[model samples]
Target: MSKEITSRKDDYSQWYNDLIIKGGLADYSAVRGCMVIKPYGYALWENMRDVLDKMFKDTGHQNAYFPLFVPKSLFEKEEENAEGFAKECAVVTHYRLKVNPDKKGALMVDPESKLEEELIIRPTSEAIIWNTYKGWIQSYRDLPLLINQWANVVRWEMRTRLFLRTAEFLWQEGHTAHATAEEAVAETKQMLEVYADFAETYMAMPVIKGVKSANERFAGALDTYCIEAMMQDGKALQAGTSHFLGQNFAKAFDVKFSDKENKLDYVWATSWGVSTRLIGALVMAHSDDDGLILPPKLAPIQVVIVPIFKGEEQKKAIDEKVSVLVKELKQAGVKVKYDDSDNARPGWKFAEYELKGVPLRIGIGARDIQNNVVEVARRDTREKKSYPMEGLADSLVNLLNDIQQSIYNKAFNFREEHITPAETWDEFVKLLDEKAGFISAHWDGTGETEDKIKELTKATIRCIPLNNTKEEGKCILTGQPSNQRVLFARAY
Candidate 1:
């Protein structure tokens, strides 16, 4: 291989950095905190988008578009949201730029050109979207307006990672309005379930479905539900979130609808989204020392065929055989690629395909063809076996399905094993410092306790898991009366 990958053991962060760059997925851009997603990375995103789009459509959601910029006046209407995102917002203060008088081939912000009101590049589309929804709803008949938008958003983060915390990233936000608070809350949890299902089944990443604590909740939201996933390095990533905005945005934007009984009431709202940061979660969850090990369902190219040869005659023979296999696999509904490039040897191609995370690879040589058998390698387990050419297509289809399930099961098991329940402050602190995974502990249900825990350990209450039973006990830190246990972890 091209210099063995930085072992995950040596440095998990460095390993991820090297893999993203050397695997031909993405590159850092000229702009700080931004990245250029290459063809390979974009293809993977396309696969994710396609699958998510279908799920949204199947659930009675319609696609729509919203403006990219939110005027200062509109943004400030929701004070809580504005304050929450202000620290990370990109603002457009000037309208134009002109050539610098003292410098050659340089431009400067024109002093003469300034916008009437500075526009805040959206970290999320709530303010602008709610303002627009005000005009669309005048009566209860307009209730439950479920809409989703696929778009790019900008956030001026202090630190950025390739896919996790980039300044600009792609995501689909679902903004829905309902007539009743109950309906809106139900919509929020339902969407959370959707995200969990997508993560576990499609991405092959197991997640814990739960509700965020008040301190960890989305700003201006009554409740926030999330799907939290664990990475191989024992860190946690919030895979997706769904928030129930109970009359917050509606009151901010003056979105009121008249009921059938002539009563005017504010609309109830819910907003949920899963961003491209999911790509990072996928990498950290399943990748190994060699390279990425993508789930078969999410892999852009499910299979790659490498033809081995020493001469023109052997090349001709392998090409013919590959052509037949390609046609058969395609007909069987498999995403397959025939790589006959003479620029690289079979061994080199093997490592290349593995780095790209193609789930299955087929290798054919003159002897193998003569024997009516071909060697197949799996990316997940790095296992190779020879199989007869007759039923090769069927075998590959089955193996891909198996890989997808196996990855999910492995992650699920890891998550199950790391959940530790603590009853004392010392134990909790020790778990946060040494274990570095999810810690379940009793809380007094006060924001003060949550904030103090974060101040002391830099660990936050990730969530209060769904269906948690209430048990009378003392708080882990305060030794005060408490009712239930909440999940804690240092999150991404």
Candidate 2:
């Protein structure tokens, strides 16, 4: 299985595809530009989703579902948002399909059953959600409505990757209503912090907390806050985003509420989301050429124990010891699996679990058990050590925590090394091509300059770092006066 994977040094793109396909994560689906996340991948997602869902609840948010299709009129309520997604929107015009008369066994859209109004599959849920909010909010008592939905969205992308840019993918979108602009902005920043924390703590991937420039902001948004992460290939990925929509959606949908002062005004709004694309980020950021290097916190199988024995009697002895260890690990709240199947050799099982990115693997044989020790291998470092069976479960608990931090530290160090400063146009271009990571350079703060830079080098301003320092400098391209530098990268 490991031989089937392409080395990252040989081809980064192919390497990613190889891992996703052969590492038991996902497969190309029958649907065009879509993927089928396999059981292993879905289990990983479930672990991630469970952690994030609890974080949302602890932050005073509630889960609620909404309609999958939005009425065309409602979708068009916000002109900028509608125009932004118009090219990708999939419309439903007919309610039913009938068998074609000329071609037997073939189905065709029944013209007579066409609906009076078209429905647009939601690319984002703001339009439909705010329309519903109009009926729900009527007074100051209903000032802040914090809701999140775990569902799938369609964007109809021309090109797609397994977990990165599919036409339809699973995600959790949070739409919120506040009574004032300040409140909405606060919510936006808060969610950005939440995303940054989640990416760093749970995913074990370091991210930069920043705000997007006007040209890159989400459509119909007053401001967009985001977290950016760098992959091992020196490319940046937008991990998550939180947008402050001001009163755009509220005004477009006429969602107004009365304050204590008896004044009626459109509600302020914010929306934020993180999707399965994070799975892509995780794979690219940490995995090696061998296979995936999943973080222990989010890995489906955090620990796997493989037993080695020649005959039934030996197998029974190893099983007895392993059963006790597994029970202890489970009691300690660890996701540990004992792979004692007879179909495969011990070495094959080791490679299979290693390719799957299990954080730690324990190998026990008759001799090792008699010696009162087991061989433990660390997936992140590929280091093996022997430990006594007694108190082994408690030791594994501490080791998992260490592995998580070690992975994050390695990624964080690489990111720190890749960020280089550019002072001139030639320098910026040279750095982008030769270095291929984040280039911090001054900008004239104009859309034309941003567009020209992207056209020239395919690098856009990922974000203006939050709380960025004020400094005197000249724009790298236009040589115009500038106040601060922003991060620029060719991204996914």
Candidate 3:
């Protein structure tokens, strides 16, 4: 029943680590940079996966998988992508292991079993997918190959966090091929909107939809559209990204199709993905020092009913009343649970659910049952109210909706306030150090200035917001001519 999480204000990093470990979401694994997602965390991911999978299907994407390892030659086909992920790639040089002759019973790689060609564990699937697309597309009719795969990827990150940045993580990647540049661009923008919608509606996290700068764009992408969300710490987290690949992948893998006009042309491509790192964004966006504060829409258990009783007779009475309420809630399409077991006490159960981020907790005691009332506590606001049990199910349903909106409004307001405009170099540096949120500033639109600013402040351009207003101005860092302001922030 005691709150043991580190305060976010005192130490944000430690607080995040504590919540993930102590809240039973995930734990550090035996592997250096991997993690074992516990049941509670996997349940959360399942709900997110179900919703996203349905969305992909509704948008005409079919689920299919490819090999986990890509041949070295195939991986090197896309030059830009190859260079971008080269350092993070894990390669299989030898296929077998044998006992060390010097140290009996110890095992070591068998130099004699070296592979003829090294295999690269996928950091992303563009190379392998495009290579296969070569055979799949022979005519314009097969231009749009909409495929999605839910898989695990490895990026050998030296510095890792529980869910934010790990060596291996689960994700859903969508790779689609189109016949024309315009169609592929449209697909890219469409997926960006989808990510923004998912973040706002389901996660109760507000995000800015924008296009990444040239230096920040995805490797081999002409343009990268992203949904950037502000964490509670005033830092930016890229919630999702959709890339317009033009004909890069097609040309790299020599994937071409005969057009309807009897002309041969390379296929255009688009790829977008969201990963388990979203779980980190969910925790940092709205969670407080107490624990995670999940939106009602995504909370695995929307309502948990705990009975406060002294003896078996009182417990049975409370259980009888809860059964009716649970049935009503389930009929209304609400995820509800009745905890009547004696493994834990009422206080312990209350604290446990609170830490788990359950949206609503209902208490049914002998007195409340006698009065035909129940005590309801909301996780977002921590407000408790006594409501009549006659129509409590409907009341709880409406309250859940209210909580979802309330959490979103709170996050939206926080994000709005954190965006500060910087007109001068000193102001930009001051804002970054003092405020630590999104700073709107004019850039020279050159990679040199972008890289210089990052070197000086460790802040990067988050995005050039979509539909950005046009105005002549000077770059805050280099005093070069500029047209519009882009968002800059220290990101995760």
User: Against the true structure, candidate 1 has what lDDT?
Assistant: 0.91
Task: Sort every candidate by TM-score, greatest first.
Answer: 2, 3, 1
Tens digits of per-residue lDDT, candidate 1, 1-492, equal 384689998998999987888777899999999999999899989999999999999989999999999999998899999899999999999999999999999999998899889999989999999999999999999888999999999999999999999999999999999999999999999899999999999999988889998888888899999999988877889999999999999999999999999899999999999999999999889888889889999888999999988899999999889889999999998999999988889889999998888899998999899999999998988899999998999999999999999988888888888889999999988887788579989988899988998899888888888978988989998889988888888888
Q: For model 2, what is the alpha-carbon lDDT of residue 202? A: 86
lDDT of 3 by residue, 209-276 (tens): 99999999999999999999999889999999999999999999999999988899999999999999
lDDT (10s digit) by residue, model 2, range 381-416: 999999999899999999999999999999999999
Of the two candidates 1 and 2, the one with more favorable TM-score, higher being better, is 2
User: Lowest summed lDDT over 10 consecutive residues: which window, candidate 1?
Assistant: 1-10
In model 1, which regions exceed 4 Å deviation?
none
**Lowest-sum lDDT 10-residue window in model 3:** 1-10
Superposed Cα deviation of residue 414, candidate 2 (Å): 0.2
Backbone collision tally, model 2: 0
Error of 2 at 473 (Å): 0.5
